[model samples]
Target: MDERLSVAPVVPRFAAAIREVAAVTAFYAGGSIGSGDYRPGISDLDLVAVIAAPLTRARRDRLRSLHRTLGVAKLHCAYVSLPDISDVSRKHVNWAHERMFRRPLSGISRAELHQFGVTVYGPSPAELVPQIGREELATAARAELRGYWTGAVRRARVWRTDLHVDLGLTTVSRAGVTIETGRLITKREAIDRLPALGVPDDLTDEIRRRRAGEPVELTEPQIRARAVVARALMREQLTRLLG
Candidate 1:
């Protein structure tokens, strides 16, 4: 890949909504889409900015422009207020993000995000993460790998098999999790490692259920239930990559 083509910082054209968000915000981290390693057909200009307040019109506009200029890699971005940094829900969001985006633009980094993880809703900035221990991380990796494999299986039903393949590839590649076979490992090989991390059989069942298009199903009102399943699966996959 030519360095010129790599996500060089371009002045983003944004709407007033996006500009408002960018101007007032104290960005923790963000940069060119797909600031990390490059993979064919799998890159996006992603941004993660932490602000002190809700985004305004200009902010939203700029975000869109940033993506458009960044090209087909699809621009992914997140905006969170400083207070939102410590919120539980926000923490979960950040936790999930860590798996998918460990490396950021050259100027942006994940260290700050991880710092937020250890001090959710707390004042201390120096507190060490006793919970995100080695064992915990290892467990997370296994679960996440399972998530990637299972997600691949289920998404294959709704989307094309190639998309599922791309999902697994993108997730793993983004997470920077090393696999001896790179991206070509078989499905069984992928699932085999997940149980060691404490992922329940129920998850596998759900993946299978969705893939099989089972008769027993939840209605639209039960969307929350559906999300729960997806979230769990995401956790497993994200954890594997980011953990």
Candidate 2:
């Protein structure tokens, strides 16, 4: 483990705890952890564990208990079976936000696995997961903007929350760059580019400060006003890219 990586201690502790319940063969760390832009409390520890076999009911129960005991919020992992590694759309057991659920292994995740995945305790991601091309990444970006974000803009209430305002806008920045250049940028970079996307400087500054683990407070009306601007910006960007 490199000392420079912010989540270095988390990798081994999580890997050991996960192996206690499942036969995790190839353990990998991706997203901010792999991209070298991890902010200790702000970023999520996105991980992947390739199991030797499909998890049994008993094993899933044990894994669920383990996550509860670990109590590390934002530490999420997709437990993928070896046989299911190649299929990006295949639904697999996942642990996120301290809850066990099932979701398809997304194309963006696979792309990150291939591009900057860190092999923590097994063979390289390239040996287990197939390489994801740039075009596929671009397509996935467009689909997300067209799909989830389209609905998010329609919902006025969700934008008022800090998590939604920050993540939603940053995602648009990231998706737009990926759509145009087929490249991934860290959240830090995305924040810097928010102004280029027509986001107000003060709002971007607040986002940056909050991401740095500083305290930020906003009144109800202020939050709602920012939310309105964010939604319109998202809608305009969606039209620019998708149209």
Candidate 3:
């Protein structure tokens, strides 16, 4: 692991919390933290924990309480049983945005685990998670756009928010790259590619500066205009890639 790819201070603490609640066989960190693109107070901490067995109702309650007590915002993790590691289709216990639910371990996340996962405890990601092929990666990226973004693009109200604009545009750019090349690029890289994807230069600059911890504000009219532009670009990219 590069010296720069250090886990956030909260990771070890979270891992310790996991041990207190359940038996974690292996724990790993992926996403921005694993890719060396983490921006303190900006990027999310994506994590995975391979546990000894499936979560029981009691354990789920405990885990939920643990996440609430920790109070670390933007920290999301999927808890998978050792047996479920080989199957991406199986739903597992997940915590995101302070909510606990069941969702499958996504293909992109599995690929990240194999590529650059940082071991907070237990074996490396490749040692446990299966290697995902390029075609599989491309297929997964397409499903995300076709499934989620399709619904998201239909909701005009969400596009007006900064979160939607930043995430929507970057997601399309990143998904397009994945579909074409079968490689995952960091969010920062996706942001840099926004202008080339026909996103307005000013909006691109706002996203870049905002991600860098700079304060950015847009007037209501400006936000509405950007929302229209972003939705159009996302719809165009989705058609181009999914077709």
Candidate 4:
């Protein structure tokens, strides 16, 4: 917490890759990774890597190093291009990244850099990231509630592990706060705020256990029930702010 950048052993390699490869113009540690909630056992090394141009061969290899060296389970950094950040409609490439990533580049991630990001090896997150409005952030959060989480438990069986439940619940809770406040909150803050934010107590407890390293198991019905409540809470919060 004392250090501005708290990260895993793999971070040195990430910075090294940025320095070694010319294609990466900048990189910033983001989300909880930047918010001083970094837990080596539970947290991920969230990042935003800005590309100098296209995903060139050298740049492509550098991106690949993230997954290969850091491992998919522990890292989820997005590789963004300037055009998408500048033009609002250019559409950041996700297909290329999906081959080696857990998720794709996001506009909110770009926006978060300006608000909550920690600079690791960048020109400062504020200077490098283009401004993305609150509506855009609200729009993205709403879609994830209606589209992504709604189907995630159904398609992938979300409650099979505590990790999924924790992430799903934590994401929606903090997302609500972010949508309303135009700022991201730490996991601790999100958990504390969940009750007033309309998150179910059982789901909130599970999230706590997930963070405490306590063993947790949920039935399919339990997960489905919780996911329904979470999705609804996010929907209400996002609508109130966005509308």
> Over the stretch 142-210, how does candidate 4's per-residue lDDT look in tens digits?
666665666664544444456555676677777777677767678888787777767777778867877
Give candidate 3 regions above 4 Å deviation: 1-7
Order the numbered candidates by TM-score, best leading: 3, 2, 4, 1
Off by over 4 Å in 4: 58-66, 69-72, 88-98, 101-104, 153-161, 197-203, 217-243
Of the two candidates 2 and 4, the one with more favorable lDDT, higher being better, is: 2
**Which candidate wins on TM-score?**
3
For candidate 1, lDDT tens digit of each residue in 10-66?
313321234443543432222222223322334333445555565456654554555
Cα lDDT for residue 6, candidate 1: 35
Q: Which lDDT tens digits does candidate 3 get at residues 1-243? A: 345445487887788789757789888889988788899889998999999899999999999988998899999999989988899899999999989999999899999888768888888887889888999999889888887888988999999888888888889889989889888998899999988898878888999998889999778899888889988998898888889
In candidate 2, stretches whose alpha carbon ends up further than 4 angstroms from where it belongs are: 4-8
lDDT of each: 0.37, 0.87, 0.87, 0.65
TM-score pick, better of 2 and 3: 3
Model 1: which ten-residue window has the lowest total lDDT? Answer: 100-109
Backbone steric clashes in candidate 3, count: 0
Q: Please tell me which predicted candidate would have the highest lDDT against the true structure.
A: 3
TM-score of 4: 0.75
